[model samples]
Target: MRDKLLMAYRSIRERRTRSILTVLGIAVGIAAIVSLMSVGYGMEEAITGELTGYADFIGVFPAKITGTTYVELGSFTDRDLKDVQRIGGIKEFSAMTFDSAEVEYRNKRVPIFFISGDTKELESMYVEPVGLKEGRWLRENDYKGCVIGDRVANDYFDEVVHVNDKLIINGEKFIVVGVFEKASTLYASDIDPYIFLTLRATKEALQTDEINYIMVRVYDIEEAEEIAEEIKEAINDNHGLDDFANAMTMGSMIEMMGDVFNIIRGVLVGIAAIALVVASIGIMNTMLMSVMERTHEIGVMKAIGAKSSDVLSLFLLESSMVSLVGGVVGCVLGAVAAKVISLGAGTALGIEFGAVVKPEVLLGGMVVAMVVGVLAGFYPARKASRMSPVEAVRHE
Candidate 1:
């Protein structure tokens, strides 16, 4: 084994320029696979992580009206809420109403979103208590209190708002109680430029007794789909239409997102495979050229006691060694490329992206390189082993 490897090493050393170029060809393919796949993996991880809180939660949206052009799904009535509350498997739930309004702090006015909900139920649906950048969350008894999002406090106005500051919304004055941390999502900006108020306060200000949507937390995540169906049926029966309301579970949404990423990963890997095919062809051509150039040397070896197997092993080993080096260099380059690209893109988009370099991905790149080497070298190695000693010597 040592002798075979030594022979291979010497052969490669004698053709340094050709060997280096061949290695670069393989390296380019492997690097592309590693870098592109890493980015896909990273995006999947980021989105999935952000959605963890919604794993067991269900969303209820009003159904669209079929016949009416100006009027569609009406707001949730008192009866609708009462019916949904009676559904089994519901651990907790909260109603939400949203409106666009201008908030005045001192003499400065800024337009912002107003989300109204039950304070405690809001905390329960998110699983974890609201994460605060400063101050505290709203309390049930604090009807005059409000919580602003991170962007509202820092970015919405000329002066930054702080806890305990007084603000007027639609002629109603309230005190700022807390600020929520920025929320992350894949295709959307952070959820940090809004205001949160209690259900009663929002209702009084909006002059509406209807709820826009309901956020439901189920007892078990595994039963989320079943619970959603039950909720849909219950709401539809109350409204006398199957499409009066729609229920969606977070788990199903996550699975759909997983399918999207799977397709993306396959397409990206396919593109990388093209580069690998080109590299494989380069290896085959280089090996065949080496055989033609060393025809007489092969004949001399065959004229002696060296068997055809020995000559085949020598050539195969040389090709494998070149691929191995390329694979290692490619792994390093790919990882660096992923990091640099992630950083640049993350900054420009105001999003967090981390390049994921999984162990299996690295190992797969090496295995592919090695397999490509053997396959690429096989025909050329066979030609060298089959050379007749007298004919090869006479030809050159």
Candidate 2:
């Protein structure tokens, strides 16, 4: 057995260039699988982490009608808010209005998502989780005060904004009462670049009574789904339209995100599998060429009492060795590629996340390469084993 293994290694070494190229074919496929799948894993981790922070929370939003033309049906009314408040298992909720406005700070103007909500409720529901980086949360009576996100305070302007800095929103002046800490997750939300105002201030500034959405925090996470359904039903009932409002619990949101990531991973893996299929063909061709080149050597061995099974084992082992080596190289390249991609993407998108390469991914890559090699080499190995010794040795 040792001699057979040594002979196989020597044969591969004898054709170093061909072996290297064959190994590289398998490497490319495995690299693609590892790099692409690592991104999926990283994204899933980021999303799940963000969602977990809101596990006991539910968001109720007005549904949009999708068809030939997109239409926002309507916003939640004060009556809708009252109906939702009456639902059981509710700990507390906050009604929020959202709009886009140009904010001017030190004469530098930038477009921003303007949000107004019940200040105290907003603090408990959203701000407390990530916490405030500076100053304090908006007070109920501090109608002229607002809290800014990390990006808005630090990144959106030439001069860094500080607490007590004044911002002009649609010609209305508001003082920055607080700034939120920079969030680590990839999921973007009001915590990043948006400005938060008290509900009364927004209503007075915008001259609107419309509530864009309501965020509810349930007492028990176990009853969150049930309470979310009730909230949706109450809103729908108030609006006199079935399914007019959608209530999404954090758990449901996470599950939906998981399904989306799963589909994306499947599509990416399928594309990578195409490269493996091409690599398998390369392996088969390489094995066939190796068998033809070694025909006389195989015949000499058979004449010297080497069994057909020994010849078959030698060819198969050579192919497997090539694939296994490729898999190792591919895993290393893939991990580095994934890290580079993750950094580049994070810089481009302004989110922080790292590529997640699990042990299974590495093991699976090696196993896949070995399986492809064995299957591809089978025919060529069998043909070499079945050759007539005299005929093979007599050939040129």
TM-score of 2: 0.89
- Model 1 spans with C-alpha error above 4 angstroms: 49-54, 63-74, 98-112, 124-130, 141-145, 164-175, 183-189, 208-210, 302-310, 332-356, 382-396
lDDT for each residue of candidate 1 in 168-267, tens digit (9 for 90 to 100): 8877899998877665445334447778888877777656556778889999998999989888888888888878787778777677678888999999
- The residue-by-residue lDDT of candidate 2 on 238-287, one tens digit each, is 77888788888999889888888999999999999999999999999999
Instruction: Evaluate model 1: give its lDDT.
Output: 0.82
Query: What does the lDDT read for residue 174 in candidate 1?
Result: 90
Best prediction by lDDT: 2
